[model samples]
Target: MTTTTYPVRVDGALDDRLNRWLWLVKWVLVIPHLVVLAFLWIAFAVLSFAAFFAILFTGRYPRSIFDFNVGVLRWTWRVQFYAYGALGTDRYPPFTLYDVPSYPAHLEVEYPRHLSRGLVLVKSWLLAIPHYIVLAFFLGGGTWFATQNWEWSVGLVGLLVLIAAVVLLFTGRYPQPVFDLVLGMDRWALRVAAYAGLMVDQYPPFRLDLGGDDPATTRLERRTPQSLPSASPREPTPRMSAGRIVTLLLGITASLASIVGLAVGGGLAWLDLGMRDSAGYVTTDKVTLRTSGYALASEEVTIHDDGATLLRRLFGDARVRVLADDGLPVFVGIANGADVRAYLAGVAYSTVTSPGPYSTTYDDHAGGAPSTPPTELAIWRTQAVGPGEQTITWPIESGDWTLVVMAPDATAQVAVQADFGATAAALTGVWIAVLAGSGGFLLIGMLAVVLAVVRRPEPGPSTLEPASAGRSNESEDIH
Candidate 1:
């Protein structure tokens, strides 16, 4: 728990060969791949839309929305594998057809690369940040916000991918090139699992008879089992250390708990920024007097409400706003709308006021909770002014405005909004590029998933035992 972290300087973060190939791989190869992802997602939307059409026109599902989503996820893993070099061709595990499965294989997978498992995992997850951006904008932007079904479908796919990557890390299949406390614990867990699974008849590699007419199996003259030389002293197999296993389990728990804490804290921060009050009209004192601190909110609050009563006593234009100063929260508004009920999303949303004009600003995540971590996220200025005056004013000159999203105060809002818009637009654009580039490589990836699902090789008959035999084993074990 020391704040200091040891740093190891190396010639390169990856193999020299990979570094040399980075140009070819990233631009030429990766670009086409991401372009493919972009188009593919576009295609997915098209196919889904067509599915709806087919349901109407032919009374059949052209494509199962569920199956299509599953396929998309499988394809994602395949591409990750290609990036990982875990398997030949793609990440889709080799398929086997069976009435009942015999051996276990991962339905979800992550690539195992030497000690660089954490980095590998980072690459896998980070690659899709771009795709998520595209999906967010394409799905959520435009005239209408994305439907809940659409949100759930994409969200579930993302969740599955995350779970798969986490399992891969905890299995110790992905090595930690850097000394990862997280992975070190996982190594101990894997060792313990290996021992426990082998405690009984876990991995019974059957001895096979040396076949006739095989040179590799040159047969010695037959001898009785007792004729062999006195057995050399065999090394005793080591049992899993109970102390180490306990320590590892605790480590895993701690790691998970930390992640959950960060997520909750970060989510709350995002909510607060999104629900701030800017319009400065609605007075809690006034509303409290009218309905004893309560009034029924309408489904929609427009410029004018029904009848003669104004929603809030405001002199100028009605506005509601929330802003974040470093890690803290503040709310301001004129006529607080009925939608306040709906604004109780995550913590970040709680801080949001009305949408501002000009460009996108990443909601400032002012790091952790009260008296917490140093801020990694930058801060933005928050202010309000009278009508026809600038909410934000640029320092370059008195009359200057940056870019216009919108603001009651024009001059100051311009400079700040422009800066935010530039940063946000760049971030969004990068994410889109990543999606498009990754998609290109993922055409090969999609093929892998489809083959695994649809073209799996049938297992030989002996590979499976009949249900009666399985039942008999259960009975004997019970007895």
Candidate 2:
């Protein structure tokens, strides 16, 4: 029987000269790297999603996306090694995504020439569930116990790292055995990350290979009959220029924004299609309004056109419906703001400043009852009066207008259930354009990101030479 080494290689060369107190401040120092890594991780996820489809159809991961993803992993490993994962290095991690050989931490993944079309579908999620469960303990962040009225949660790795930090703080020495164990756990996590990220087809082994140097790179050569000596270290992978990094980040940000836009546009389109009545009106849920005043009036509203003809095309007639709570003949009317105010002047009424079932507010006026009945007033541009329900329809024109609701008999204590509706005939087209435009920008963003992060092919003896050049030498192992 034979065994193969894992393709993911995580290395931490503990710094010879250590800073005792630096580990404490490394958390604050790594803030910039953490911030950058946050965005990079988001981009990594987006690119990985793209890779999943590529592998499914082409049976191979896209090389450009692969390099970018590997770079992100490399960047993360260095930060972990410096800050908390192992505290193996004192050197500040570089901001770039490329590997830094002098930085005491390294990570590399072998580019797979072929991938299982079927495996790509489940490897990142379903197949990785067991590893995820184990990782939940190793790197679970922590557990929360809420019923006890207090919280207690800490991951095994975090606990180990804290102990290591305390020991180093007191003795000025990082315990070698603790370092080895932490390294092993970190290695296991990286391998699982690679596998679950859909970067490899091989399932991660349950075994933990503990040490600063990977056991696969060293001990396997001496112990296994089929193993070969480790190859000479290769040159560092080319670093993405600062400009390219900026471009990639911007692209990812744009793509994320575009996704939000798509969601909003889709929601709008869905509502436009699903909520409209036969008359092309979208109505709000009716709410009850009660006031011990002679009339119920809406706050004066002013609509401006600004000569934007699109507004006129986008909106149609507005409708207001009022149903009397006590079966009294109700009057609902739309009129100029001044006219309604003048008609209701010297009369006790309530101005509905805000209207909702739970958050309704009003400006109450103290005066005598109306001098004349609302049904006899000619101020209303459009009015409806009936026993059970009254609905008024007014063309949505640009002007100061107000809606007045009252009993036709000029009595106080007006109580009615009211609803507002609008014929937004152009909404469907507007949302459709939004969806289409967002999709277009999403493509542009993805393209920009790919171009920014993808390793460009260099002139070499063979086209495959570039792939080999970029391949991590640490990945070499007996199959």
Candidate 3:
């Protein structure tokens, strides 16, 4: 057994002449790649977690899983190289996970045969914390945390690359110094990723091996022969069958759908609670009313039309309750300004008065007709017999209206209360049903995905491949 430097290697050659405008559109051009990578990363996360437990017990990273994960990293590096990582390549990245010899950006990791079971538990998360902290400043941290707020300055590598891109756009050359720095940062990040993924036991170095080639290879003198630890029978690489692919796809789809459902359901539930519990009706501070032979006391009430949905409008209503302490009969009626004015004008001896449109109080109650006639609409009145307490409710509509309270024969003090109901009980049932149904589909999708990832595929003769055959040779060349 021998010791060497880090096993992960990342390399990229800066293209001589980059297109001035291409960098601007590179993000758009790579949308398809980003979409595919999104799903691939999800699979990668699941596989990495699975590999964690496997290594914990068996002391080996599954060779097939290793290759697939490496491919994902490789593919991601190429896209980043072309777009924001290094701006090192103009050639479009290939969609396949297998290496493309012609592609400018490359990444490869030497597979570790026997992993320390004890280290596997902490290295990916705990041991990698320092590297993660450094990479956070370099790469701007993981987008998952960055997305929680508006702070966009997370990725230092991306910012520098953009500067390099601008320099390239104007000067037609990617600065050598900038490119080297970007690569160093990228290399550092990838090294941390590999370590955290359980691909290597050698903790990543704090040093930045800048430029297209790794500098450590020249410094490290001896290389140990890589060997698998004695363990359970090695299984052949599993070929992903069409059925397995479908199952994984179903799982991914369901997981994504469940996220959407949860978000929507949670939002709807919040809205429903707000509507049902909101203060629906507005009440005025008690105003003194003189109850005497048809002496009308008019209090102006204005209702603002909330442009709510038709369903809410259909289920919503407004009610006015008249309360009096004198126990004398009180006549209460609600009408748009015009009808009340007409009715009062016809009464030979009655005094009709109201407050200004914006005024909530009726203090300036002057004699004669109101300066402004209330907008006329339908009118509702309680029986003139004056039941001390009466309530009238009507479908809610927006407008400025007046509440006319009259004492038929006696003088008594009184006040009116308005209550608004904005939601129906039935809607709560509907929302619950929607949440339950969406949640059910989401659970099914998640189950499908977990099963697909946890269950090992069947082995076949065609699935056998020498895992060592594709190990990166760049390290040897660089050394």
Candidate 4:
């Protein structure tokens, strides 16, 4: 047996070079770290949920979780740079799995970008598809499941599974690199986001844990530089990353929620107006009522609240029992049998007083032209009446008398409105169901994408040539 002991150097290396960025990173993250992390994590989480559901519904998008994480990371870094004054300033972007200068004798491994740009963009923008599908199934499905008398449990489970499968499958076509990077961020951030997004799904939490990644493991010992560039390239330019993806999704979701909120609020306001304007009609007789629409009987209506009634009157039936005309009930318009029936149903027609229809033999006054005797014929057509210009003409003789009545027309209009509510609900339900079904099929197509890159794995930088960053492109091309 042999024992070898080396002299211990107890003094810490105070002269060791420090990464200037270390201080910035430490202080920058101390207080605001959680806030940024929370916002970014929530964003990506929502995106993941939406994207997964979208793939399920539409049968489109990349499916690899690693690639998805990468995309999110890239996006988040760019957003951070811009927000933190790094972009358009002299600071590097944050959380970039790419562009993270490799530490000396260290590795910068990343999951590959297997998806195409066209497909990736399409998937990114259409994340709304899943959101809508999820919303529909949640609200509409719940309603249907509750109201219907069918045993929908088994079918529901099958349907939901199908949807999940489709989403996973469809996403396989575009194994986005940006999304992969997001998952590669600090484990804590990734863990929190995962918890929010995959709570109900088969998707698991981050493969790596937070605060577990060591900076020293990836730090590099760069050769002394001749000079640092006076004006550094604009940092945090928009780049693909998992974090960025989350940001985009969050922005979209927030916008969508705002629009929906406005619409619902406006609708509630309208309902309130209708309730406020409600009134019970009071009619005296069967007058030829003219209005915008129909008239309903009280039995057909259910007044939930009280409202005001509008009374519009023309120069007719209103009473004038004052001075000069001595108690005359000014009946100034046409009359009919219904009016008389309402006024005095059983009274004898012959017993009705002075206002009687008279018929006489031909009078030979002024060469056989029959007299222009007063009759109820001309009063059949309703006379026009406006406010002032809206008038009523009496075709009856100067002393002729006719009866009139007051009627209201509000109840009938509500009957026409009754069908609108049920119709809208049915239509909305149908569309939502269709969206959910589509999401399921979409998920089926995403599985292939997941398989493609999930197996590809992240590679070490040992085999990689350093990026054309510090060196000139012309020098490499010439070589």
Model 1 global lDDT (CA atoms, 0 to 1): 0.26
- TM-scores of the models, in the order given: 0.19, 0.72, 0.55, 0.24
| Cα lDDT for residue 319, candidate 3 | 53
RMSD in angstroms, candidate 1?
24.7
Q: Model 2: clashing residue pairs?
A: none
Model 1: lDDT of residue 86: 23
For every model in order, what is the number of clashing pairs?
Answer: 74, 0, 4, 76
- Candidate 3's TM-score: 0.55
Residue 370 shift from truth in candidate 1, angstroms = 52
Worst 10 residues of 2 by lDDT: 219-228
lDDT of 3 by residue, 318-343 (tens): 55556555666655667675666555
RMSD for each of the candidates: 24.7, 6.7, 11.4, 23.6
Candidate with better TM-score, 3 vs 4: 3
Q: Give the TM-score of candidate 4.
A: 0.24
Ranking by lDDT: 2, 3, 4, 1
lDDT of 1 by residue, 1-479 (tens): 12321111001011112122222242244444554454344434434444434444544332223233323333333343334222112112322111111111111111111122222223223533543453443223333344524222333223333343354445523223321222222222222222221111112111211111111111111111122232223422122245533443343333334434545545443333443234322112111100111111122223434221322221222222222222222222222232233221221111222233422223222221122111211121223333332233211111111121222211111111111110121233333444454444344333333332231222111121223343344222110
Instruction: Note the Cα lDDT for every prediction shown.
Output: 0.26, 0.79, 0.64, 0.29
| Cα-based lDDT at residue 1, candidate 3 | 13
